[model samples]
Target: AYFKEKGKEVIYDAEHFFDGYKSNHAYAMRTLQAAAQGGADCLVLCDTNGGTFPFDIFKVVQEVKKNFGIKIGIHTHNDCGMAAANAIMAVEAGAGQVQGTYTGFGERCGNANLSTIIPNLQIKQHYICIPENQLVNLTKTARKISEIANVTLNERDPYVGNCAFAHKGGMHIDGVCKASSSFEHINPERVGNKRRFLMSEVSGRKTILDKIQEINPSVTKDS
Candidate 1:
């Protein structure tokens, strides 16, 4: 009402209102509809405490979209390890935008990792969320944001983490040697990430072969 009184657009950050606090989908739907009818430029659904599964999120988001024709957005937390999945499901259910902190950094577990969401949407689902050439800049963008916030980056964060594209297991490395798709669902290069080969006790000849091929493709596997 304040924004409307001022003749300005209202954007509500309704994250986590759905966690375990309100288990009623019907109520949620009604609330979102009312917000839209009241003149919200966009309706944002949040996985407030995280922990929401993809299937559940899909069901709720689909209903919201069906009931309200306004723009939908998703803000997910990383608790219970389903932030990325929930965000994706929201899109599938008709959400137009995704919001999250880079590298999933936030209060508790973390917010959705935009790095993972961007590539998954663009490469896997063929969503035009980001420009094709600019995709590679994702990692740099995440790191830059982390630097600005003065937060330490997680090495295991998806897509942009130091270890996101690293490989260690012999069998996994061998499969990647034949084809990166064998081990990685999406090409690391697509997200400005380079493939890594880690040698350890579990490393084998196949691992070595794959690493060699990755380094010098001219060398045949038989050699």
Candidate 2:
């Protein structure tokens, strides 16, 4: 009523939705209905404490879709290290939208990492979030956001991280040397990143051979 009077849009964030659903599933459904009745354009189910696992997220979201028959969105945090996975699972289970931040930057453990989610959606799952031409800027955008926030980027942050594509173990490097896809989930360059062969004590003969060939094409493992 207030929003209608003010002519403003309503986007109800169902805060602590996961916990609420766990406590009383019926009550949570009612709350969503109430929000929809009050003119919410989007109903965002939130994992406020970030404890919801991916499986539960998927199941609950599936139920929500069946019952409500309305558009659903997902908002997750990272306390349990399942935020990104939870968001992805929700979308897989029928969520129309996902709420996240660049680099997963937020309070406490942070929000779902759009950096990870974007590539997993567009490249792997074949969902079109942005144009193909602009996908390359994802890594650069993540770094730029970190710089603006005056925070050092996490090198292991899924696709955009410096070490996300780095391989170090002997067997892993061997697999990558033979077939990049064997050791890598996606081609790093697809997201403006690069595959890196990290030299370590775990280096195998294949690793050494690949490195030599990079420096001099005429070199062979036999030599």
Candidate 3:
């Protein structure tokens, strides 16, 4: 109320909100009501311990959105490896904003990975979280940020990971050869990654031809 009277924006964050809501639902709602009555500009629900499941998050956020007329946001951690999923669920249930760290790196188990969340929300869910032109720079930017932070980016991280689009074995390569969509979720080029066909014990003639065609597009099994 004091800040609102002074015309300063106040974003009240409800930390450990998930646990609090689970422990005492009515009390939690009352606390949020107090913040709203005090003129909070926005209310951010935080999963401070990062242990809540996605379903629980969805339910709580849904109820909050229904009761509060203010902007709702989500802040999650990755201790349970559900940060991105929980964040996405919150958005689905009506969170207007998502709080996360780029490349999913932060304290303890880290925060919700914006790298994963951005693509999932933007490309998959059709939300406009970033400029359309900058969407292609996701992988490169993640790498640069990881390098600067001296944190080795996980090669298996979703969307920006090196192995995210890599295909191996003869059948896998053959499926990808027949149709890029067969073995990939989204195009690697769309996010500045590349499709890799690793040579494996199962590599077949079709796989070899596919590799050769990379160097010489005209070369084929018939040729």
Candidate 4:
């Protein structure tokens, strides 16, 4: 009512109740229905306990969609190591948007990793939201948010991680040098990430040549 008085839409986070109790499909359904009736723009189902499995999430999401004809969103935590999977299941069940922290950093195991979710949605699922050019800005946005929060970035994060585009194996580096798609699922440039060829026990001549060429294309092996 307050929001409506102010001419704004209301959205229930639905975190507190889920965190305090175990999985209650009935409660979730009732809450969603009530929110929809209350004029909510979207109903966000939060796996605050972080104990729900992918299949369970799918079931609940599907039921909610059948019950309410409103838009659905998902908020998952990483406590059970299935946050990403549950989020994907919610989407498959017709959830339109996913909400989470940047590097899965939060109060507990952290929220769903947007870095992983974004790539999974765009590359694998082929869903379109922002412009292709703005896709690269996703990484920049993550870093900026992390900086503001004074949190260190994770190196192993799927698409936006520092090492996400790094190649170390001899065969992998060779293929990437010739054609990035040879070893990479998606071009790093597409996400504003730079491909790195790390020199070590696995480094090969092709890797060296590629790095050198990148620095100075005019210089050849003889030069």
Q: Which model scores highest in lDDT? A: 3
Which ranges of candidate 1 are over 4 A from the true structure? Answer: 5-7, 19-27, 205-223
lDDT per residue (tens digit) for residues 1-223 in model 4:
5686789977767774344334565675677677777888787888887888899889877877787777888999999998888899999999987888777877688889877787788778888756767888877877887899888778777778788899998899888878888888888878877788898888888778877899899877677
Colliding residue pairs in candidate 3: none
Model 2: how far is 12 from its true place, Å? 0.9
lDDT per residue, candidate 3, 4-99, as tens digits?
999999999999988898899899899999999999988999999999999999998999999999899999999999999999999999999899
Model 4 compared with the native: what TM-score? 0.85
Better of 2 and 4 by TM-score: 2
Instruction: Give per-residue CA lDDT, model 2, range 1-223, as digits (tens).
Output: 5896698977789999999998998899899999888877778899999999999999999998887766889999999999999999999999989999999999899999999998889888999888998889999999999999999999999889999999889899888868988988888888898888877898887777878899898988778
Instruction: Report lDDT (Cα) of residue 165, candidate 1.
Output: 85
TM-score of each: 0.82, 0.88, 0.93, 0.85
Candidate 4 wrongly placed segments (more than 4 Å): 16-24, 211-223
Clash count per candidate: 1, 0, 0, 0
By the TM-score metric, which is better: model 1 or model 4? 4
Model 3 TM-score, 2 decimals: 0.93
Best by TM-score: 3
